[model samples]
Target chain A: MSSSATINRSSAFSSPRVGQRNWEYATLYIFLAPFAVLTALFGIWPIAESIRVAFTDSYTALSDSPVYVGLDNFRAVLAEPAFHSSLWRTLVYTFLSVILNVSMAIGLAILLAHPRLSRGRTFFKLAIFLPVITPDVASFIVWKWMFNQNFGVVNQALLGLGLPPFAGVTQPGSAFVTLVLVEAWHHVGLYTLIFLTNLQLLDKSLDESAQIDGADRWQRFIHVTLPQLRPAITINTVYALIEFLKTFTVIFVITKGGPNFSTNFVSYYAYSKFNSAQYGEATAIATILFVIVFAVVAASYWYMEKGDQR
Target chain B: MSDGAVTDQARRSAVRATLESTVLYTVATAIALMFVYPFYWMLVSAFRSQEAILSAPLRLIPEHLDLTAFQTIASIGGTPLSSFAFNSVVITVLATAIGVCATGLGAYALYRNPRLPLFTSVRYSFLLTIMYPHMLLVIPLYFVSYKLNLLGSTLGIILVMSLVPLIFFIFVQFFRSVPQEMIEAARIDGASEWQILTLIIVPIAKPVILTATLVAFLLNWKQWFPVMVLSTGPETYTLPVALISLNTEYGINFQATMALSTLTVVPVVIVFVLTQQRVMGSFMAGAVKG
Candidate 1:
């Protein structure tokens, strides 16, 4: 509240702020200089350079200068068989993971919001949320152990149920499922927390009115609940989609996109190019990814706000 | 009677819910086991003999635990754990301090006038930066870092690694929640912009500032790409990079990997236990209330 008083005081005396001219801008400039320099020199430079690198024949062992190959990099990327396979796989992983993560999070948010579920409830959230904070490498190691083909907990539980022992990591499709499941499990906690928080902000009277109308648990959730949670759904979906697209460390830990390039995404492909010493081609891949990601984020924000405005 | 049938269906629904409650508890425990087991396994595996690791992979129960991995790590690396930890501490501390300050100032500037040049554009860019893949930025950014002679230096890693676009965006959103009258009072005091930012603004944001610090630290501590790119030697490498190297060099030994993994997660667990509320506060503010 004191901040309000201070803010009012400052805007009242706003003019002549910062010593009145370029000569007096030194203090602010000095404070801001470190960030601006670092971002410009490294952050923006790489992004710009990557675009330049994408338009040339930059993939060969013999070429140092990356001969002007105009659109060839894009053409080559599109033509590569693995590129299409990887792209499709990436899309599928992102789609399935986001849908599962967001939906379960929403469901859990509703369940956990029950007033009866109050006592000792914080423990439940912390239990689920622990994985979200676990470092990717460590969490990856844990999941790998759980998905162990023979002796891991998952298989152990399955066998304990008198079911057939599931073979693991030996097939591409099966591994993809395990990977997605692990990713979804790791992330659901964050969304649950997100959605649950949003749910708490809504009008209690609305839920009460529905109850007065003789609504039950499932009805309250579906009608009175779900529609009110759309804003959260939008945020959660955007976050999950971006995160799923950028997933590398987990996959790197589990299968290294293995049994072939079954789980590989564009980011990892870019990493592979760097390791392969095709710097230009690597930069090209990254540039394309940046463009794609940038476009998605921009369009989503534009549309989301437009929707909100209406 | 139709009424009897309706009652029967309701009974069936109640039974189904009881079954679901059982399922929920089971799923919850199973997830907890998955989440918590690695740390326990790490403790056991890190202590057990190498031969034990290979021969008894299915042994959920540890037969015998020893500190051979710990001893080895201690002897050759001569404080690999501590040094890696120390490096992480230094990097995280500086980055967080610098990050929060920038965020506070930027948020204040935007919130005060809302007419700041490119304010909306800045807001949009920060949002976009959340999706910005730093992994993809690794290669190209490495070249720039190399040119700047920042490669292999802690200073370089800290500076370049401090891009907090999301942090900035989140704070701007956070600042919007700060009542406008506070800014007005600060303005009325005839305080300089910096004075208003430092004295009046930051104190109000302490809770979220702490939350943001923890989040940023967790993110940076686990970050391997920039540190991996910059640090050429063991001494300079941060914990995550060192852990990765340990995994490969140790031949994917699960016990050792778990041990190192356990080490990486200790700070988060400790911080979560200590300040979970501050951390959860961020969620509370943004989420819609039920």
Candidate 2:
């Protein structure tokens, strides 16, 4: 009864004052209006339009009207051998890249966070992260040069060591491996940073208790530290999955979906379709890719939530 | 146990610790080198002649500084380097400025009225949109821009780029931590919401603003896919697009491409170096909180 009376008294005191400040609503709306309009136009509208266009026989960007063709676009896209290969390639690339990236990230995070290795923490962090901040096109272009077949530094180093020359984006056989490596290098830093942040926030007392209970470093990490890192692991896995699945910039710069379509992922494939004025089919591919990404992300979230409950 | 045995164990453990640190340092240094070597190579290659860059027994360091590649890029045919640089600057600046401001305002509005049904829905919608990949929007956006007569224009790019959902989320997160009592006090003092936001909130939120600005700047500056699809002509091409053209047009001129890449990268790198702490802090904030 006393708490209810206090709440009533506070509301009584503030209600009239807040009532008099009606202009605040207008100001707030004014502040929000531009962003809301822009989001609706560019952010929300495009998703809706893309889905709509996927079911239509739209060919050109300038076309005012496109005939609705139901699932024809999807059917056509699904029947194509190129689409099937690109989709498979995308999945394979995404799987390899995500695993490589997340593991490297975990390793680097642990290395950087180690107590004994105090010197040059900042240097290592900065060096790893430099690529993340460097303009993507520029860095990818530089990587392309570094991986050049005849004039590349990579081949030079390998040949100097009296080893057989590594094929760097020149041949179909090794292009996928090259793509994975370059993508991992470009992306692992951000994931590492994420893991490092999580590590810093971990409860140190749990590790101390494990140590006291006769757990060795590996056992403690597996039983205690790794559990604490579950959230970071989930986040990094999902992020890297989405990132590599839709990988475009690297392919655009390095391979252009070649050394004979070895590195042609789905995004680049859809881009090629779009360039050829197969708008309907292109949107269908995009819509399919979107569904896959959304479904995977949703599933991961659900799985993580279930894991947390346990 | 005897005191001598205890001392012996301590010394042995210390030696082992030293060995562990040595191994960790070696691994860390090697990894850092592997990550950083490409950048080092890029910088050096920019200043080397094409022949020197491709020569046998590749020199890690350039023998002599060469300005020919940089000069060549500066005056390449009909579309010069300056135009591309100018387009990039204009697009990045306009997009980041408008993006950061609009995002800040929207976030503030949501933060101030957390209970309002409309604002709550808007907030949730923004959160949901972040899940959709950029590629999914490209096709429709291209058509939309065409319909709106915004295709092949910087205006369209700026507007589209400014609709960044992540920045909005970041701003909202930052604002939520701000004490409500401060805003209430300002309200009671008859300071308008606009005044409170401008005078008080923005000042307190400088770090978030800087972080968002840096992110938006880098994103806009480096954007290739959308810009590539949207731009129909060389005149509208940004640095990245122009860099691609340079490669295709000149038929794999590594020296010139390196110089152009250097131009494109140096500004962002300099900004990043200057504000490294805040950028890292922002990433931590997003990771931990979001």
| Among all candidates shown, the one with the greatest TM-score | 2
- Least accurate stretch of 10 residues (summed lDDT) in model 2 chain B? B281-290
What DockQ values do the models have? 0.36, 0.51
lDDT of 2 by residue, B92-159 (tens): 89999999998888888878886764776666666556666786577779988887889999899888
DockQ class, candidate 1: acceptable
Off by over 4 Å in 2: A1-22, B1-7, B115-117
Cα miss at B131, model 2 (Å)?
2.2
- The lDDT per prediction is 0.69, 0.83
What tens digits encode model 2's per-residue C-alpha lDDT throughout A1-310?
Answer: 4345335544755574455445568788888877777777786678777788888886533466668889999999999999999999999899989989998899899999999878889889988888887888888888888878766888889888999988888898788888899889999999999999889989999999999999998999899989899889998998899899899988888899998899888988888888888888888899899889989988998998899799
DockQ of model 1, rounded to 2 decimals = 0.36
Predicted model with the maximum lDDT: 2
What is model 2's native contact fraction? Answer: 0.61
TM per prediction: 0.85, 0.93
Which candidate has the highest DockQ of all?
A: 2
Deviation from native of the Cα of residue B164 in model 2, angstroms:
3.1
